[model samples]
Target chain A: MQKTFKIVDEDGIHARPATALVNTATKFKDTEVFAESGGKKVTLKSILGVLSLGLEPGDTLSLIAEGGQAAEALSALQEVMVKEGLGEVQE
Target chain B: MDKTALSKDILKLVGGEENIEQVTHCMTRLRFNLNDNKKADKAALQKTDGVMGVMINGGQFQVIIGNDVPVVYNELVKNMKGSPEGRVSSSSADAGDKKKKNVLSSILDFISGSFTPILPAITGAGMIKGIIALLVAAGWMGTTSSTYIILSAIGDGAFYFLPIILAVSAARKLGSNMYIAAAIGAAILHPTITTLLGAGEPVTFASLPVVAATYSSSVIPIIIAVWLASYVEKAVDKVTHASLKLIIVPTVTLLVIVPLTLIAVGPIGVIVGNGLTDGISWLFDNTGLFAGLLLGGTMSLLIITGMHYALIPIMIASIATLGYDYIIPIMMVANFAQAGATFGVFLKTKNSKLKPLALSTSVTALMGITEPAMYGVNMRFKKPFIGALIGGAVGGAFLSLFKVKAYVIGGLAGLSGIPMVIGATFVYSLIGFAIGIVVAAVATYIMGFEDEPEAAAAAVPAATADANASSSNSAVIADALEAETAPKVTEDIYSPITGEVKPLSEVNDPAFSEEIMGKGFAIQPSEGRVVSPVNGTVFSLSKSGHAIGLVSDNGAEMLIHIGIDTVKLKGLHFSPKVTAGTKVSVGDLLMEFDRVEIEKAGYSTITPVIITNIAEYSSIKPGGRSAVKEQELLYTVQA
Candidate 1:
């Protein structure tokens, strides 16, 4: 399952939020997730990925989750963003 | 009655304010920017109040305020604004107007200050790249496989979309349209351009040297280009009508710049970027390892000044060419090493205020942005910065010896460069980094600087402030401190201003001046009454009652001063309290003072009120400033 989101928050992707998303996805070994745009895919577990999207408000990003926890993974990622004040949008 | 005695004691030093320009402070130093820096009775200021030492550097007058600098700097900046000259003083640097920053310089500052915010992205990506290298080396992921896709993007994402970051940073630096910079960056990083370039053969669109250095992961080139673009945008905006300016300028710049950029300019600029990388490599190869060693050691310093950004392209080029350079790891060690050194200071100091700043700033340094640490804590200490340098030197030497290299282009921050060491070099990198930390810490501790949080105070006055004998009131006799000497006769007589007074021993703070219990006294001063502390001529009192210098009937030279950092109040409400040649009696009021307004100005009311000429007296008794009545048994100096 894949979902798209725009990094709507002002500071773009950064420290606490980026670290939160990366560390969260690192917990799921059976499930793999990544963020993509323009055919370039980056590991969802990599803090560098979310930050490098350099995603500013309105920049749409697709989050791809593979395997059993795909829907849960997307929901969980969104929950993390909401909890940590990241992305400024639902997954 | 030591208050009057203490007041009298103070009347004999440095021939007061007619001498000083401004007085300020750092943690351990009282920094004074003297109007007539020459007239400053440094010996007097040092002896006044709770002074440690004075250090003058880079046009900044410094007082070694000790671990209490931030606290004291606030006070000093508030108080030291008193220019005895009463001319334009830094105190006039009031809340709002002093914001007069050099517009261009601050822009530059922004570019440099902004680097740390995005460093984690670069480090994480670089580390992932290193991990990917390890993975491929282990045959766990084929280079062309989907697994490689995920991992490569994980590592390469930052560099791949680097222009986006540069755009935001450039927007901040240029202070121009941020989104415009990002849009322009997007134009530069457009996939069509990448796809076209990947078509392989040299593609020529036009001839403007649209030097596309592939803004993807390159640090400097994009920054420089965007900065230039901003200027063009600015200039174009001025000429075109407001509405059309933004639309036309960007459109024209894109249209004309694209084709032109593709041909002569693009290829040339690209070459320039490549050449820049090669030139650095050339320097490394030709200069021997000396170049790496030099940069590695001083790069932290350079980063402190933000000049290190100038070399980012070189490191990037190294990644482009040999895919390796030793500088980043060296910088990493230097960064952490500096943090470690500052951490030592944080550990050794007992100062309540200094410890937290040291810890926080050191953490920031470990994160690779050292400016806050350097400016906030280390440089203030004087030795920690030196410790950083020593650490850097050893680390540089180690890096040079190990010949370790970095495989990625990134900010010179963090341990991301560790895994990029490739082959047997990893061990050397680790060894070098360890040696750096150890050398820095051991050197800092062993240098005997660890115990002295107040080191600035000790180093402050070793050098004399003035050599011009003709200019200053040379009333102070060069006699040393004598415990049993008789009171040398002088025209100078200092008086306690307030009515209430007591023995100097009653007011407490670590005894008067080392080992002497309140030899210096305090007065429970009336909020605003100024009296002549001495009977001697007011050798100096340049209009502001903030300070007064007098020569006693006996030959003692002293100055009676008021309030800590009260000089910043700038004579607004306080009366001159006295004149230079005023004749005074023990009870005669010299000048009406204002303690309320002084306190209102955010200054410490704990006025030192001391005698600058203590060396002349065998033993000045404790006349408490707080309890003794006027003209009581203040001082019984032996004659």
Candidate 2:
């Protein structure tokens, strides 16, 4: 499953939010989650990889999940992103 | 395994090349992010010969190597996993918490990183400015002439456009796009904006009031602006589609950063720069000699810490606003004082290896380049550094009393810079420079410093032996005299053969040439016999009888190689007198070789007497002599 989220926070995907996103991704097993930004794809579960993406405010993040728990992982990641004020679901 | 072998072995023990995601190094350790932590043989790696210590923190494995870590790191990256170009990708950011940079290092890193690239540019221009000032003072060129105008413009270009130049370099350092950051530099210095600000008209951008700060010739503001743009550009990139990123990133970054700079960054930088200039001027006006002493004494220390760059803006601003500055003259004395300390070290040091270095660095220190003198000579001897500081303070006080000023920006604080100390202040500056060097040299000579602790340590046993021998009997004194009147109690090395003593630095082989084998002296062997230079046991005797390693009872290790590449001779003309593990005393025959036959074999017969465990000692004093007899004092190594 693939979903596009527009970053809403003034500071986008910084340390705090990157930590939160990685923590949320680790909670689900049998599913691989990735975030694509700036034409680069990084595993969302690795804080360093996510930070290397250098996402900032008003940026679009493409979140992808694959495997048996893909749907649950994607939904949980979206919720974490929204709750943490990192981004909002686009449609 | 040795350092290189250990470095190679470490790669396999840590799950080979594929397992390492990233590798970086700090001052002492090679930090690596491994794909599988469990795959590494931590215990085996720790036991490696050259690996000092091992650490695993925050998902990174660190191998501690001492001063030779860089050598091992080069071996690993160059020979093992890296490409032909030997470029190892350094992703310090992805290495987790292990790569955390604290505030002090960050500021240091920033200042050094930002200034290093532009120094050559400024240095060249500064030299030209000095030349121009000289030309004008000598009446060689009129300041208003067309030729003078063109040359001055070329000279002034770097300083005037410094903000724009800093913007490009700073942007690259901050990992932002160079053009966009430079555009911000351009916008700040734009004719329209400068005109509006100059006319004292109230300016507004997007209906928000603009703070009028003259941003030309600035440094810090553009650096701050570029740093901000790095974040702003990244943010813009994250939201914009790949197709629109090229346009949107620049547009949004400019629209957001330009106004922010005029309203905030530029104003703050102006205030900071102005405050430093005012504060220094106030100190000079009120405190006088105290202020001079404080600045002069600690100026080199500031350079050491990299806080000296903070004063550059104040100097530039003072020259721009006040037409002259007192700080440069004081700094010139500080530099010359350091040179004087180096001269003192050169005169007093018994270590021949340091003498040449001290001499050259002293010359450079007088020319206002103190790094070689500061790091190579003065800091090596703590007392000399203090002497320099005292000398600088003394000179600074004199200069302040005379109210000397540096009227022009120049390349260095050296003698050549006297052209910039024009007007009545010139004579005082010259006097200050002379006093600084003299006082520093005199103080350093009087204070006196110890260089080789190993030589000193060796002397202790020799002293005790003399006392014991003297107290034992008249018979012991006869035995000592029979042994060619040798000092029976000191740790000093005696001449193994009748020959002229030469400093090891003059040795032909690199092993001894660079003092890597240890600090000792070389001998032009005039005789065929080689005797034990120290009262020690033979640690090892090469099977070929060309080299012998000895360990003294007091723990000094000496390596004696008879000839250059004599190992290839295979004992043809060499004969051994002492076997491995056999005890030998000074003047005892260890080996004998035919000097003429060895010379006929195309080998240089000069032998290097080396202290293999030299790092244990603070200094090693080479015996400076033209010629010596057997059992004559060769050199001293103190612990």
Candidate 3:
């Protein structure tokens, strides 16, 4: 499952939010979540990897989750994004 | 995984922050000067998630962390803050080990430590000189052209002011005032001194005959001057008043040291440097290939002991006086030989960790920074170093036979220094370089090393295992797993505030007195300052500065709340030195509060130092120090 969202947080996905995102993504067993932005893709479950992407406010981010609980994981991650004021699901 | 979590784990495995006397990192490893080597669990560190390997060599406990070392280093620094004393006193650590080392090794350590920090400047300037040589050889830039002159000056600047640079680094190494050392270097290299020397006229300093020897581009004179000046500065500082020390110490030290250097030390150094140059020149002239073979075979040893720096002055002096240097060419073959051996290791090693390191280090060695290859790969494997020595010996003999010499001081003895031997025998030098590498590689291949065993490979498999593990994991899941599987370990938490110890029941607040927050003790703080109780990151700090949370290296979460209901003051009379996410060490000042003002504000300053996660620990014992001092053991928790 894949979904694109525009970063809503003013400071973008920096250390705090990146950590939160990683924490959220790692909750779903066997599902590998990856975040892609600006031609760079990184495992959303890894804080260093997500931070390395250097995602910024207004930057489009595509969240891709693989494995059995991919859709449920994406929905949970999307809900977390809204709760943490990181980003919102597009459409 | 998280860098902070990884740093904490590494710190714990290395016997926590208390065990480390000093810590520094090179390109790939975290080098630690541990107070007790036995305290460090090297086995656990090797099996760590981020750590690739661990080695105890050269009086340092080294942890290999690969490329992301700086990030990890920063995290480690954050966790530990500074050493236990809150100052980086490297000399104290060295003093303890000094007795164990022989005089030669001690001197080498001093020389190498002094030279290591300034290598980038030397290598950069050498490369620029090589580029200029190439430009001139290609007829692309005329020697008279402004561009060429500018570039040439840029390249020559480092060499010209070599004494000043060496003075600063040497002063730092010797734990003396660097500015004063620089002053001494500058005085000798001053235009007036240089002019008087260049004129070939006799100069005298207070009836003492001064030797008219070149100081610019000279290495030995300034290093010796600084070494003596370190002692002189100390002697002068002893008599000087604390208030006048800023002005009086440097002035008296400079007055006494500069003239002494000009009349005595400088001349003696020049003579020693000259004698070394002469000796080497005579050896080359008399023994021929044997001199090259001996020097080349032993160059690695010289480098390891930093005796190579002693040869630098001789090489420069030879270039200045003899028109060409024989040492640099021999050194070049030695460097290439080491690189070749490293390449051989890369080809032979099945250890995935060693393979990439070997490959990269070999490339780096070819470019002239060979310490990584020398220490990380070649020396670690043992046989490769010997293979490199054999290769160096053979190549050195070939170079000596061809009478190959470097016409200029260029980049370190590697592929980059080829333009240095741009004279008639350039082709022969190149052939010699090639021969050194090929012979070394073949020799290393023939003499195979005991490769790193499969069990020692920690990083790759651990990463995959982590990825495949249960997703419902905390930040320190690995640590949690280790704790559950491994033996129970006990950790001590020191008192953050220096004051009279009080029972938790004495606290006015029910939340703390009732042990609802967690079970621990309180302190009736006499001092205003608050320091970290453990080596860990600042987990949380309230906006009012009344409470600060800390998570220790061993995962003990603590909360130190200052005064009863002092949060109502809204940060008034309170100052926090660290914010959330700040890495702190025991004795590192965390905050300061006005005890009198808090009392006047009707708040009782009974600071509760509680282990918030007390359920995780099996037992908590008091340190029994009633008249407590900051960093004194307050509680010991067994987990």
- How do the residues B85-184 of candidate 1 rate in per-residue lDDT, one tens digit apiece? 1223333313122232235334434444334335556667777888888888899889999988998888777667766676666655444565666676
Tens digit per residue, CA lDDT, model 1, A27-90? 5656899988656677876543444454555667787899977887788887776666555454
Which regions of candidate 2 are displaced past 4 Å?
A1-91, B1-100, B127-148, B319-325, B349-357, B407-424, B451-639
Writing each residue's lDDT as its tens digit, candidate 2 over B271-354 gives: 787777788888888887888888888887775554675676567667655657889898889889999999999898886556
Return the TM-score for each candidate structure: 0.47, 0.52, 0.52
Q: Where is model 1 more than 4 Å wrong at Cα?
A: A1-91, B1-110, B113-124, B172-183, B186-216, B235-249, B256-272, B283-288, B312-322, B339-378, B407-424, B450-639
Chain B of candidate 2 vs. true chain B, TM: 0.57
Residue B315, candidate 2: alpha-carbon lDDT: 75
For model 3, residues A1-91, the per-residue Cα lDDT tens digits are 7999999877666544665677567666579899998897878865445655656678889999999789988998898788989887886
Q: What share of the true interface contacts does candidate 3 keep?
A: 0.00
Clashes of each: 80, 19, 1
Alpha carbon deviation, residue A32, candidate 1 (Å): 68
Give the CA lDDT, 0 to 100, for residue B465 in model 1.
Answer: 19
Write model 3 residue lDDT over B1-639, tens digit each, in one string. Answer: 688998899889887787776566654568676665546765457657777556554345668676677789888988886642122444443334324334654575566556655665765776677778778988999999999989988877877888899899888767788889998999999998899877988888888898888887777888899999999889988998899999999988999999998888888888887788888888887787888889888888776544685676677667656757898999989999999999999999897767887888799789776766776678757899999999899899888877788877745567766777877788989998888899999999999999877543452246443321111111112222112212335688899988987767689876677565665789999999999999988866766777787877887777788998776677799999998779999999999999999999899999989876564554455554555789988877656
Worst 10 residues of 3 chain B by lDDT: B468-477
